[model samples]
Target: MTRSYDEWKAAAAAMEFDGRPVIGGVRVAARSGETIAKTNPATGEVVSQIHACGQEDVDAAVAAARAAYEAGEWSRAGAGFRRERLLAFAGLIEEHADELALFDSLDMGKPVREAAAIDAPGSAALYRFYGEAIEKAEDLIPVTPPGSTALVTREALGVVAVIVAWNYPLEIATWKLAPALAAGNSVVVKPPVEASHSTLLLAELAIRAGIPAGVLNVVTGRGSAVGRSLALHEDVDMLAFTGSTEVAKQLQQYAGQSNMKRLALEAGGKSSNLIFADCDDLRLAAQKAAFGSFYNQGEVCSANSRIFVERSVYPEFLELYAEAARAYAPGDPLDPETGIGALVSEAHADTVWATIERARRDGTIAAGGTRPEINGSRAFIEPTIVTDVPADHEVHTREIFGPVAVVAPFDSEDEAVARANETPYGLAASLWTGSLARAHRVSQRLVAGTVSVNTVDALGFTTPFGGFKQSGFGRDLSVHALENYTDYKTTWMQWG
Candidate 1:
């Protein structure tokens, strides 16, 4: 149930937040005794002081994760044991769903309604999905030559470090944590300094759910500090990251420079949404286009920021799309009725506004391109749509990571696919069409990890989620996600 604005305000007023780093299963002050103020983007108020972890803090978290792994309390536990505990963790998350939702909503200015209804429940569902998958996993016994036997098994990698973006704090963290923990790997999580409250709360809940002490630790700080340290730490066995493409490259280089630890990265994306003239439901398509480009204020990695409409329907679709986009006007994140919330920070809003200004010079603003002050904070940007964007314009090629989309007309299906594939990112794509053959043909040719026939950014726990090219490799969901945390082992015996 969605709470009233006043109720949400009262809850925020009553809530007390602690942003200290969680090391060895307990909240601890940073050794450096330094902290960064976490400002609420919605209200321009300081929410709490988050720890600024340095190298020493990263070392301590890694040591604790390693100790937990070597202790074999969680690492050596049976699949059933892990499954049961993970289920309990999932239950705990559901029990505290409101608190988790509030944490992300307050920390990062996500709409409380969406954060409560989508992210929190979705996070719990991921835990449950991965927990159920644990017991279903089966070892392989390959055929062997006479007098010989071979057994293949999957084993957990020790001390995995997870770094997630601030956009979808608890959800993204859970995407990595559920599989890593279910696979029996002790983990150290590095949440973005912009939004670490929810992650800290998640770790506390993990402990309460009977997870082994030190099994899951959260280090909250700037990415350059805690994040980079985790990437370079020699003790870390594996690292999973969700962030910018440039950061992914840096993490890869850091891994090479240090321990050469295993890395699974889900990086940046400028996904495309192609609307063919044959689409039967233009109005529905336009609504989805708005949602694709504006959901989560377009802070999503796979947001369809590039829209290619068929020339025949371009004018009509553009108008409908603009009308749809206007529905996402930014408002108080705490208000359940608000569809759009503030950006992650004033700094991020400035960056987006700069992009909008550039887009106005090079492209036509079809929908929204304004930032209105809310609660004395100008961190709220309207859902913006830009049309007539030059093919080579910066807004057309670069990722703004905001509720801004660029629209253009394509003459043919081939042209649409070609232009869409021209991007450096291959994370996701969406194409609206009525012909089954064209759908299959175009979907096959799209240079994206996931292609949606009539939807945008289609994903589920049952399907693998990842990307190609600079969007980085390694899957995030489905049974394939387990591969991120586990390594295969083989045992052979021969008697002659």
Candidate 2:
């Protein structure tokens, strides 16, 4: 059953936070007296505060993670022990699901309903999935050419540093956090400073689940200070980050400059949702197109921002797309009926609206291209759709992280495929058509890491998720994701 709007509001009202950085399994403050101000975007009010950690804080977190990894309590624990504790963690998260959802909604401006319905439950599911995976994982013995036998074994990668984006705070963090821990790696999670509350709350739940101190740590602060320090720290054996393409590259450099640490990065996307005249369900496609572009206010890295319609059905689909966009008027994120919410920050909202303004000049503002009035202020943006924009426009090329969608028409499948890969991003793409062969053929040619047929932004924790080209590399889900956090070693022995 879907959660109602009033229940979402009640959850927000019941939300509580003890704002402090959880370092080495303890709630503490920054040594430098810095603090991360949590301003609620829905109302422009400072609702909470977290320790604004810097280099010293990062060092402590890393040291703690390293100590725990070396202690072998978590890293070397038996699969049964890990499985029991992880399932408990998942159960605890579910028990406090509303609290986690509330924290995420307040911190990142995500809709309360989405936080409760999607992010919170999704995080718990990932933990259970990986917990089960770890328990069933098997080592292999290779057949030898002679009397000797070779064995391959998977081992933990020691201390890992996980950096999650603000858009889907708890959910994305769990993508890394669950796998790292399941693979027997102690982890320090570096959540975006503005949205640290959910992670801080998660740490407390972890402790309650009987996860020992130092096994999982949270260091909250500005990315420039704490994030960079963790990325460059030699004590951190591996880094798993989910954010922008630019930041992922910088972390790659940081790894090389430090201990040449392992880095798994899931970055940005300007995914395309190609709709053909022969599509079986244009209505579903259009609705998903709007959802792919406007869900979470289009803060999703793999948003289907570019909608390319077959020219024969372009006008009809555009109207349908516009109609779908109109349904997502921004409201108090706490409002359950609200389809869109306040963006993560005022500056980000400015950038989003600024791009809409640019689209106003460069393209036809098909549906919405202005900010919404809420309490006589402009904290929220109306979901926007732009048509007739030139292919080379920045709004078409760059990622405008907002509730904005750009529509264009393509004459042929070849043109659609070519235009889809025009942007530097290659994270995810979707094709809507009836012909199974065309779907497979186009999917083969598309450069994105994941392609969906008759769907937009089809992502689940059961499948490996990542990007290609500038969108960064590494799979973040499924059994394959465990590879990102583990190392395989081969042993050869002579039994004869």
Each candidate structure's TM-score, on Cα atoms with residue i matched to residue i, is: 0.99, 0.97
Candidate 1's error at 146, in angstroms? Answer: 1.4
lDDT of 2 by residue, 1-496 (tens): 4567687667666677666788888988789886666788877778877778889989988888888888988888898889888999999998888788888888878888888887788889889999999999999998887889999999998999999899999998999999898989998998887788888888888889988899999988888988899889988899999999899989999999999999999888899989989999888888889989998989999999998999999999988888878778888887778888889888889988888988898879999877876743366898888888889997789988889888999999999999999989999999999999999999999999889998887878778899999999889889999999988899999978
Off by over 4 Å in 2: 1-14, 145-147
Q: How far off is residue 424 in model 2, in Å? A: 1.0
Candidate 2 C-alpha error for residue 219, in Å? 0.3
RMSD of 2: 1.5
> Highest lDDT among the candidates is held by which one?
1
lDDT of 1 by residue, 3-62 (tens): 899998898888789989999999999999998998999998998999899999999998
Over all chains combined, what TM-score does candidate 2 have? 0.97
